[model samples]
Target: MLLYTESKEARRDVVRKEHDIIMLIGDSLHDFAAEFKNKESTEYQRGLVAKEAAHFGNDWIVMPNASYGSWSKSELKMWNEKAEK
Candidate 1:
């Protein structure tokens, strides 16, 4: 189904319908589904991802989000050229 709306419930209803499997191609976590929306914290979101780790890259195709939201306040590690051995 081609859903083009801002309502989360509408999207959820589409998902509830019995039919072919739906795949979500999203840049941000919120675009995936209703369950992953309005999360408490980044850590909590990460936990939810971990909980449904198997579906990633298969059912849900994740793309890098350019516009920061939850990760804006995160501390990122510096990239290293060589192995830290």
Candidate 2:
């Protein structure tokens, strides 16, 4: 397994280049199309990344860390509950 870290801004650059699998970690995918919701970029780079990943015939997994990555709010709630107990 390999891990690659990239910012949302940077992903716009090479998303359509070429790759076997494009696993977008965190809650970014939830808003993948949000960026171009009102924009004129019909390419839908985010979707393209996902599509390309699938077309490449490789397995892609978007595993976000519950404790730190995208579930910080829920994790905090759980922590507070534990403390209250």
Candidate No. with top TM-score: 1
Q: What would the per-residue lDDT of candidate 2 be over residues 1-85, giving only the tens digit for each residue?
A: 2235664445544655565335434333433433433433334544665564652323334545555532343223443667787
Per-model C-alpha RMSD: 3.6, 10.9
Worst 10 residues of 1 by lDDT: 76-85
Q: Write the per-residue lDDT of candidate 1 for residues 1-85, one digit (tens) a residue.
A: 5557746647666667865656877777777766677757767887888988888999889898778766788777545856544
Candidate 2 residue pairs in backbone clash: none
Against the true structure, what is each candidate's TM-score? 0.67, 0.25
lDDT of 2: 0.43
**For model 1, what is the C-alpha lDDT against the true structure?**
0.73
TM-score between candidate 2 and the true structure: 0.25
Worst 10 residues of 2 by lDDT: 70-79
